[model samples]
Target: MSHRALEVLIVTGPLGAGKTTAVNRLLKAEVAAGRRVAVLINEFGAVSVDGALVDAERPELAGVENLVNGCVCCSLRDDVVATLKAWCDQPEGQRPERVVLETTGLADPTDLVDLEQEPELAGRLRLAGLLTVVSCLGPVDHLRTRPLLRRQVALASLLHLSKGDVDPSAAVAWEGDLRSAFRHIPLVLTRNGVAPTDSPDPWRGDLRPVPEGWEATAGPSFAAARSFTTAWDHPVDPAALEALLLAPPAHGELLRAKGVCAFAGWAARNDGSDRWAFQLADGRLEISPLPLRADGSAPSCAAVVIGTELDAAHWKRALRALEVPPAGARRKVTVRP
Candidate 1:
C-alpha cells in the first residue's frame, strides 16, 4: 500500500488581515497544478460569510468544511478533529493530496499545533507549516492588545505582512517591533496578496457579538478601533457602497472594510449568480469581479468594517447613506475582544 500522510497547514491572522486572499490564491494555484486539495474554514461569527466567499470560488475541492459560530482553537476543537477524521476516512481514490485549515483571525495558532500532538491524527496527518498574515492597516494598539499574537508569530513557519507598501516607513517599524516581540520567525512581505517568489491570482473578505443590556465586554487596548459584521437581505448600489467605504463620515474614521455585497437592477451584477467583493484599507479602495456561483448557491451580501470610534449607530447611518439592505439592527450583541 502506497499510503501518504495528509499534510495540514494552518493559516492565522488578525481580524482585518488578508488571510482569505492569500489562501484563495494558493488554492487556485494548487488546483491548477492538478492537486486534489481540501480546505477547512473556521470563522468566528454567527454567519459564515468567509466560508461563503471561499465556497463560491473553488467548487471542485475534494471537500470543504466550515466550523462556524466559535473559534476552533477552543470551543470547536472536536469539530475540527471530526472534519479531519472524516477526510481521512474517505476512500484512497477520493482523499485529497493536501488539506489546509484556515483558522479564525482570533484563533490561537498554538492550539492547532497542540491538535497535531493527538495520537489518533499522528499516523494520518502531519502538520506541514504555519502561515500567519499581518495587515499593516490595523490600529497599532489592536495588534499589541491581542492576547495570542506573540505565540502565533513564534509558531509561524512563514510570517506574511500585507499592505506594507501603503506605508514603507511604518512597515519598517512594524517589522522591527515584530522581531522584538517574537523569537525568530522568518518574515516576508506580501505583494498583491502573495510573496515575491510566488506568482498570483487574487482576493476576498466573523465573530459573535456581546449581547444587549449586558455590560460591554472589556476590549483590548484598541480603543481607537472597532469592527462590525453585517449581512443584509436587500441589494446595494455599487457606486454608493464604494463612496461609503472610501470616504466614510467623521473624517477618516474608517480604517479598513471588506465585504461581499449584492446589487440589483441593470447595473446590479447579482443575476442569480456572481458576487461583488469590495475591499478598503490603508486609504485605498478596490472592487473586484467575483466568479459566477455554483448551481443553487445563494447570493452573499455581507461586510465587516473597522474604524475609529465606530459604533452601531454610526455604522447603521453609514450603510443607510448607500441605501443598503438592513443588516439586523435590533440587537446589541458583541464578542469579547
Candidate 2:
C-alpha cells in the first residue's frame, strides 16, 4: 500500500472566539477514535499561552509545535512552511496522520494558506480545511467596525459558533447576522464542545480572498506590524501577574496574551507544589495548575502578547513589575526557539 501524506487542519477565528476550545474537543475525539495527530499552534505575541494550554490538555498526543512571536500571515510565513515541510519529512510511521494548525486571532486566513501557492512549499501538502470559530457573545459592534472579522468569516469553509449557552434571542440574532454576512459558508452551532457534525467536507477547498478595498478602510499599515518574545528566569507572583495582564497599558495596542508563570513559595507539584498557567482571551481568563517534572530545576515562564506598533521597553517595564523576585537577582532573560 502507498503511504498517504498527513491531512492539515487549519483553525482560525477572531480574538477570544473559542478556537482553542474547539481544537481541544476535536483532538480529544480524534484520540478516542485512535487517530495519530500533531498540532502546530501559531501566535502573534512573544509569549504563547495557547500552545501551553494545548500541551497541558493533551499531553498524550503525538506532539505540539509552537510558532510564536508573530502572526502566521506576516513574520512567521516562512517558519510555517519550514515546520510543515520538516513534519512531512519525518519517517513514514513517525509522521502524524492528521495535523492541526490553530492560528492567532489577528492572522489573515487567506494569506496563511496561500503559502502553498509559493514555488517552494507547494505540491508537498494539501489543505484539508479552514475552520473559523466565531464567538456568539463577542463584540459584534467592534467586528462591524473592522473589516478583518468579515474577511475571516468570508474565507472559512466551516463557521463554528461558540458560547451556545448565551441567551437564545442573542444567539439567534448573532446567527442571523452571520448567515447573512457569510451566506456562502457552512455554519455549525456548538455547545459544551459538541460540534454539529464530524464530516470532512466542512473544511475543504481553497480559501477565498478578502473583498476589495476592505483592507484600506480597516486600519492603516496592517502589514507593517511585528511580534517579539522575552522570557524570564525568576519566579512570578501568579496573582500579581494576573493583575498586571488585566491592567494592560492604556495606549498599548495589545491584541492577545497567553502563557504559563512560575510562582515563588509555590510547590512544583501537588500536596504543596504546583505550577500555574493563565489563558486570556477577549476579557475572560482561565487559570489552572500544571503537573511539574520531578527535577528540582525552577519552572521556566513565558508569554506572547500581540499588538500593532508595540514597544519592547513598555512590555519589559510591565513584566518586571510582575516579577516576584527583583529582576536583578535572576539570570538574564532569554527567548526560546
Q: Worst 10-residue stretch by lDDT in candidate 2?
A: 215-224
Among all candidates shown, the one with the greatest TM-score: 2
Q: Write the per-residue lDDT of candidate 1 for residues 52-158, one digit (tens) a residue.
A: 66876754788888886677777798898888878877889799878778987666665577655676676788777778888777655555665555555656777
- Which pairs in model 1 have colliding backbones? 44-207, 45-207, 209-333, 209-334, 209-335, 210-333, 210-334, 210-335
The TM-scores, one per candidate, come to: 0.73, 0.80
Instruction: Give the C-alpha miss distance for residue 266 in model 1, angstroms.
Output: 6.4
Off by over 4 Å in 2: 59-63, 115-123, 166-172, 196-217, 220-230, 264-273, 293-299, 309-311, 326-337
Candidate 2 lDDT score at position 61: 71
Q: Note the residue pairs that clash in candidate 2.
A: 46-304, 47-303, 47-304, 48-304, 49-258, 49-259, 129-203, 267-273, 267-274, 269-273
Q: Write the per-residue lDDT of candidate 2 for residues 1-337, one digit (tens) a residue.
A: 4457567888988767888878888788778878878888987665566765676574457767898767777778888877877777777778677788898877777676665566654665667878988887766665576667776787788888877685566567778888887778878888865676663454365566545664534451236455545565667777777786677666656665666677777756643435577666666666777644445332357765656676767776666556666545755653222
